[model samples]
Target: MNASTTGLRRGLQTAAVGSAAAIALGFFSAGAANADTLVPLPDGSITETLVDGTVVTITRTGETANISPSMGSTPLHRNVWVSGSTKVEVSNGGSGTIQPGYIVACQLTLGGKSGTDGGMSTTWADPDGAAKQTAKTAGNLSIGPGQAVDYKILDLELADPFGAEQHRAANPYKGKGSVTWADSTLGVSGCAGYAQARSYVKVTVNTANVTGNVTLWGQPFSIG
Candidate 1:
């Protein structure tokens, strides 16, 4: 072959190889961008004494959060699937209702031992104007920046006294009861900042003489 022709052929081969390498790199990058993240969370438990000398123990076990890429393929959208179980034990033949759920927040910090955003408390009823409450039972949440909302995992449908169908977030129980949830969806949108979620179990116990409430908080984890 002529000198110029040989050089041209070699250059073409090099360009082809370079293009193939680039395509492979792009494919791997896309796969990594769309990959899911599995988070094994730490289990937590709490014990509280009621006003009537009744002891209550609440335990949260097998907690996990599977964070996924943005559902909308944008920074404003975050999706997560959470799984966990809550067990409650009451003393003195006390009965109670168990409420297990998650608290998802955007840009705002949760108030607690591990979370302290402007000294705000992360209780079930947020007296602070940070986040508005929602009736989203199945974990489809929508909130703006600096906002947080509660997500109940259970949606117990029952007939009311008037024969109308109603949904209850709490499950009534006797001495000992437990609830398990799997693959609960938590979809957040309309927030351009970082997002986080935490698990919570609130139990309202009633004895023959008095009634009280005990709450257990879980570790907070990032969604995006």
Candidate 2:
């Protein structure tokens, strides 16, 4: 409850940052790692601390919120890195097209980096009956250790995904879209290595139509 103590607590409460060494060990809530030398946290979970000038890290059992868990087969969303930053800006990107009972597929760009990097992802089946899945990313992104990138993966207009009956060739359920992510968030401030930062993207499509559902399972893309 002292002024100095209150300020330190507030600072640490913010997303932990920077590199360093600590003058004194600090009190952290339980579940805190024993110390820089204690039993390591399980893999996936992350723990970092900055005290005085010391930087401490402890690993643990957990999932990187952004990276999807590995699936039996290719996951519905998987991250792939591109040459550019992963931070992207998407507009309503102009209204997407939807006809009475047909799906117009998004054009695919094929070949080299442009081809390999840009394209509509394969349409995946909705595992559950309800169309709950869609492409998207977690809020504010973690670009690297102690670093974060900010960007909005603009939502595009599309029809909701439907059931098995709607997956017909003639009544094609589709729309067009383009994705771009840049590491523009990183800079000379606390975020270092401006040129090396990156961002990850998850694309989801689910929209509703009068007669049928239309949707594309999410696919994760990474930009550097």
Candidate 3:
């Protein structure tokens, strides 16, 4: 083959390799994000809707994990979360609060134990005048020979004038828990959460004024 032809072939081969590398990089990046996936608990899980028309699912990972943010570092006794990497696309549940846009709230629990007593919750907010994230754990359980009582586990709470533009009173709590059931007292342990996972996450990029979507990655993330 001519020298020119040989050189052209080499150049094409190099280009092909570069494109392949790019594609491989894209796939790897996506995989890295899943390192933080929220595993289901020991025979426990819950699916609920946020006031903002977005659905949220919770599951507990039998293991424990550490979450470090600007506030501080916390070691979640048991791994449980709202599935941080899991994303979803949703329409506006309510009108924009500030107007010309919507909001998105993503939440993950550092530690969660459910269907029992006392658990952790954590909620991360994304919008104007918001904190990075917050978590809490709280619960109550009572049993008696004559009667038994099961205090309700706190679900997501909404603020007055609830909606997409509104605020969440509680959600995404975090912490560890165990059952100390005896003939007498049932030891209940934990705190409570208060923030907001409005199901509103800002699209990494957008031109529209109204924040119709509330997501972390801008587009739909983990629905499947």
Question: lDDT per residue, candidate 3, 76-183, as tens digits?
Answer: 111222222222222332222111111112222345332212211122232333322222222222111111122212233454554544333222211211211111
Candidate rank order under TM-score = 1, 3, 2
Listed in order, each prediction's TM-score against the native is 0.79, 0.18, 0.21
- What overall lDDT, based on C-alpha atoms, would model 2 receive against the true structure? 0.25
lDDT by residue for model 1 over 1-224, one digit each (tens)?
89999999999999999999999999889868797899999999999887778999999999999999865888889999899998999999999899998877777524322233432245434423323566454767777666677788889999999999999999999999999999988888887678888888989899999989888888889898
Residue 209 local lDDT, model 1: 91
Tens digits of per-residue lDDT for model 2 on 126-194? Answer: 222211222223322323212222233333444445532322111121333333332212111111221
**Candidate 3 Cα errors over 4 Å, as ranges:** 35-224
Model 3 TM-score, 2 decimals: 0.21
For model 2 the TM-score comes to: 0.18
Sorted on lDDT, best first, the list reads 1, 3, 2
CA lDDT of each prediction against the hidden true structure: 0.82, 0.25, 0.28
Error of 1 at 171 (Å): 1.0
Model 2 / residue 29 / CA error / Å: 49
CA-only RMSD, every prediction: 5.2, 23.6, 22.2
In model 1, which regions exceed 4 Å deviation? 1-28, 108-131, 135-137
